[model samples]
Target: MTKVISHVGFSTTARAGDLATLEDSIRRIVDLGADVAELALFGEDLIAGGRIIESRAKRLVEICAKFDIRYSVHGLIVSNFMDAAHLDWQKAVAKAMLELCRRIGADVLVQHSGQMPIGPRPMRERYDALEREALSEIADIAGKAGVRVALENIFAVADTEYRQTPSEVAETVRAVNHPALVGLIDFSHGYIETTRIGADFRAEIRAMAPVAGHLHVHDSFGRPYTMSKFYYTSEAIALGIGDLHMPLGWGDLPFDAIFDEIDPLPGTALIMEIGERFEAERADCLAKARDLAERVNRRFAADAA
Candidate 1:
């Protein structure tokens, strides 16, 4: 069975340094009936004052174990391995994050595709070469640590910068072709990408499903295209137009269509990337979200049977 997890995006906020917040969030996730919990750790948690601290990493391990919850780690977005200028620093941070993953018994470490800034020239070969090399090295470390390094697809403001689309991400994962490296599809991002390009959303999910080792489960109101923009409004919020990450059914995303297109794989981690907008009622919202996900899982499983 696929284990559903919920992410606590605390690392991007002031609460990243607060253990109490982390604990409370994890407790809520478990209580919401999730099978696992994911925590995003930033570079600050790995290094400080120009030094690495195993103590801090160990504390996180202790906390997760205390609650008896299975967990995974999402490396900081700044831990980019594609850019040569910051490759060394980013690699170091990524390595430390893998160490944290090992200590926490996390079997997967989710990462964003290497940072490839938008440029004037066509740089596909150059970018692919860099990603291939960097991900290979990262994969070796993850393999040795018994963890898979999952490169998640992201929606780039410039589509050419990185592998943003589902097929593009699947291609990149195949190019790396490492046993310890796999592709992760952010459903919300995939939806936006498919909608923007007039592609079939189910086909997008099908393309990535074979290599999908993990998922960022979320919802959006409408697709955000590269050529246009939509202003935020109270009305828009109610409609869940943007990457709202509201409770599952709050948006118009075709969750059933996407799920039915592919069978759930064993050991796949589904992280509910519910944005912090629901912080005031996070517990209530998460409970509802979990219920929806469970219903979908059962429906899909029965369909497959």
Candidate 2:
């Protein structure tokens, strides 16, 4: 069965200064009927002065044990591997993250692929080479720690085209060809990138499905046009081109189609990456998400029968 996990990242965004509060916030996720928890590790907390916080790593382990919640860690955004200059720092951070995963008993770590420059400079081939190099090192780290590292698809924004679409992520995984490295599908990111890049959403999902070890499931209405905005603006909402992390049905995503593609897989994680806008209604929203996951599983079983 696919494990349904709730994201504690939204809560952490507010309490980034005080990570201890994550313990309290995550306990709420367990209460909401999620089978697992996804802890978002920002670059600020995980990467500093070329090292990881040993004490904070210990605290994270304690938090998971306290709640008895099986967990995974999302990689830090600031430590992206795309930048050539950040490659050394990124490697250090990756090693640190692997150590943390081992200490905390986390089996999977989701990482965002590096950003693509707005204008062509390093060339796509070269950039891809750099990214592959970074992933190779990370895969080795994860392998040694007995954990898997998932490379996520990040959508392109105005200034930079974070060209790591689902297909690209899959191709990267294949190129890296490491057992410990796999693809991660973020629905919202894939949805937006598909529309922008003129790729079929279903095809994108299918291309990545074979290599995907985890998924970031969230509702995205349309392609976001604005820059540096988290919440959907009034204009964007009216135009329906924003990546709003609303509830499932709140958007026009074809969940039935997505689940259809996922059903045949060997049980990938279904993690809800709801935005902070729905923080107040998190419990209720997650309960509905859990129900949706169960419903999908039942349908798959019925189809198999």
Cα lDDT computed for each candidate against the true fold: 0.69, 0.71
User: For each candidate, what TM-score against the reference?
Assistant: 0.81, 0.85
Error of 1 at 201 (Å): 2.8
lDDT by residue (1-305, candidate 2, tens digit) is 33332222222232664666676667666776666677776632755655877777677677767876667777776557778976888778778878777887878888887776755655877888888988898898799898899888877766366576788789999999999988888888888888877788888888987788777777767575654453536555556676766766667888766765553234456677774456676676666656656665676667766
Q: Which stretches of candidate 1 lie over 4 Å from their true place?
A: 1-14, 49-51, 118-122, 158-163, 225-241, 275-305
lDDT of 1 by residue, 217-285 (tens): 766765564334446544556555555566566677776666655543446677777645555655565
lDDT of 1: 0.69
Error of 2 at 245 (Å): 1.9
Winning model by TM-score: 2
Clashing pairs in 1: 221-240, 221-241
